[model samples]
Target: MSRPNCEDFRHLFVNDTPLMDMRAPVEFTQGAFPTSHSRPLMTDDERAAVGTCYKNKGQDAAIDLGHKLVNGDVKAERVAQWKAFCEANPDGYLYCFRGGLRSQITQQWLKEAGIDYPFITGGYKALRRYLVDTIDEVAAKPMSIVAGNTGSGKTIMVNVLANGLDLEGAAHHRGSSFGRYVTPQRTQIAFESDLAVQMVKKLDRGIEHFVFEDEGKNIGCVTVPLSINRAMQEADIAVIDDPVDVRLARLLDDYVVKMQRDYVAHYGEEQGWILFAEYLEKGMFNIRKRLGLERYEVMLKSQQHAVKMMQSNGSLTEHDAWLAPLLEQYYDPMYTYQLSKKADRIVFRGDYHQVQDWLAAR
Candidate 1:
């Protein structure tokens, strides 16, 4: 009845375990289990102190100091909070760095209180290992993919599925420079760990259907697994076509300023504003080249006042002008063409509800 093993992680996930992370506040903030609401047993400073103690003073001293820090009253407080959480989620699980002493201490406290729960064996390290191993295993098996051009909502649909990998979301980062809204770009290892977690979930659901945003080897900084990429290349694809205007609107709305906010806020008001002014007249045309004339014109008009304000103060760099057009007119289009050439071609095409139903029925 206890949620402990990797084989049961999906059950814990479905049951909505609190995912009590005992690692430390900092790591939790970076990235951890996607569905888990984390409550760190050790504060950032406390964990760091123990780590320093372990390295400098040796294991015995570290344990003594850790004991000194984690006194009975404080321990009781942790048990109380976790007890309350577990009361609500009887299936909740706890993990510490490497699933070691910290988690052991916490679990012992639970047992002393007569709470018989099994903690994740081997901790986050094991979970991380499971993620890597499982992703590789799943990749060797077949998977179906949904591929499309930029703004195809392919990434969005992946998350909506009853089960699947949301690579862009998994990374807590999107695949584009402009797509780092929900969380800052993750460390390379962290991104991969997160992705592997999703892969395991998808494969375990008895699901071979994979929906991937047609990404290059690198999405900003994170590199997706080659196996998953290979599967994507081989799977049947369907272009999630939206009108150029509609796609264009989504592109700007997702990236550019909102509520007519100064375009500079997209970067930063002061510095980004200055850049917009200095480069926009010349640069604006270049952007138009990629975003397309109509959409580009719309954003330019919207950003015009901000452009003027900055120009009155200073100038934006125009250095990217030459390459921007190349990326816009030639490279981007070519990339799409290659994706079309590579994929098995459209298998299904509809809006998400339609597509979701298609996936649901299957």
Candidate 2:
């Protein structure tokens, strides 16, 4: 019996289908789908050898080298791994860089092992193209920008909306100097793949109008796709106009309280506290030039005192000393200037609930 080739890329992504990536480890590390697991047919060295043979001799010679390299116990071991993955993810499909020789050989081996499995028709390249197209297609729809000063709960508001696209969430950074999480952000390729998959899933649910947080091109290390960024620039803006105290409290919770808790959770109490302090200090140091030498010095001193106080008494309130000034002196003015440039695009300006309601109604 002949095994079928899976070509419904949207179905695979929408359902979060398990994918067995047969590319070399180096290729998988560069980029892969969220559901993809790297189970390469050739090691990087083996692939390099075969590639050289293909260039110097030809495809037939390359094939001979690949067989010789991955034969005997090696071949049986790989087949066993594939069989286990197939049994575990009965609905999963396998693919290589292209729907070419590597995947075909794997499928044939699986068949010989008495387990027939399908491969993606166009493989990794095609799947990536599908996701890219999804982003462009969804970005063409109507969109709304959630714009506000730092810590105005814009991200929170975005999460509350049905049509909202949390770009920062996809990028895994909070979109600020203090936004780096305890965990590292995704690779640029992975970030784009994630964002594109999100668009696909959201659009599948019939969400035509997308709500996105106001952001520049870069969100920490990852970039918003140019198509989506352009749409955001042209989209209507909904400003979350919370009081200064409210914004400050929100920021304190997010940056200091929760961030500390995250570090502690990840690294245990002692080391977590040290790393937490270093994280904040590094954030401050990163913006020293922009904050001005004198002001930065003052703020850094306050921040250091706040960290010590928190370490001693578990008092998070002391963070407000530097955080308040950071917002008032640095973030507020900068955001206010940025907002002014997009003033013409402002469609609704209200506190969190009102903005939430406005976005929901849209």
Candidate 3:
């Protein structure tokens, strides 16, 4: 039960060792490791009480109150939960805000219960710092940015790469107003943690070249790490040259069919459609500045018509009328202007399959 058999702290990042976050639910929700499960050493109320004691009386008083609060059946139940987690994941480690009192106490209690488990050396804050530092360090390496018109299946191509990192996937967004997913986006810290984890895994595998979709500074609410964004700005661009029709079909599949499916899966069918329609409306409204009031109204009307047609058991093709014009008038010009500014960065330009082959061969 001693700390001699403790797992190495870096192993938590590089390997699949599970982590039991002993921070309260509120703290854990704010941020924690991906592999972590919330198993608090104290309830939120108990933690607040202990914190107040620390502030008012001192550390000794807080410790006394903490022990007093978690004693008897409450302590026993928590120990049981920790024991179960340890038993299930023999390599599991525990952590607190600073790898200090709380985790030490948890480890000590578990030790007394005959469950010999080690905790993270520096705790949640330390591990988070390490992960954040790793992101900038890894961002120094060369990156290849996948670029194409909207709906060119650039995300799919990035995903198919051997060394591809899905920035949008990490953000739980498609990187646009309409790109909201049924699931919530990660907190900023969580998004950075995820991005760092991907890079760490790739680097650990001896891969130096990282590939990902070209993205703006923000993917939804999460900003790309500054260093990574800088590298992306300097990275070579791989463009997808699929025809308009091909790209349009992909947009429909992703935006309409897959989006509706996700919404229904999260919220039942009846409510899902309603939410989906709202999402579309919001997405359109969000782009009103770029679309101009008149053009926005036109697009909105077409979108509403498409929604009604779908509701009436009409074909998805009905969406093409608005989508095509939206792309032609809005998305294409923006993307083209952006790409033109970086014309020197374009490394490979081809159709989807051609790009796939080009990446695979590399």
Using TM-score as the measure, the top candidate is: 2
Q: Per-residue alpha-carbon lDDT of model 2 for 113-201, expressed as tens digits?
A: 99878999888999999999998998899999999999889888777788888889889999899999999898888888998888888
Collision count of model 2: 0
Estimate every model's Cα lDDT from 0 to 1.
0.63, 0.91, 0.86
Candidate numbers, best TM-score first, in rank order: 2, 3, 1
Tell me which residue pairs clash in candidate 1.
99-123, 275-316, 278-315, 278-316
Candidate 3 per-residue lDDT over residues 64-116, each given as its tens digit: 99989999999999999999999999867889998899988999999999987
* C-alpha RMSD between model 1 and the true structure: 7.0
Q: Rank the candidates by lDDT, best first.
A: 2, 3, 1
TM per candidate comes to 0.67, 0.95, 0.93
lDDT score of residue 43 within candidate 2: 99
Off by over 4 Å in 3: 1-10
Better of 2 and 3 by TM-score: 2
Give the number of colliding residue pairs in candidate 1.
4
Report per-prediction Cα RMSD to one decimal.
Answer: 7.0, 2.2, 2.4
Worst 10 residues of 2 by lDDT: 1-10
TM-score winner between 1 and 2, please give it.
Answer: 2
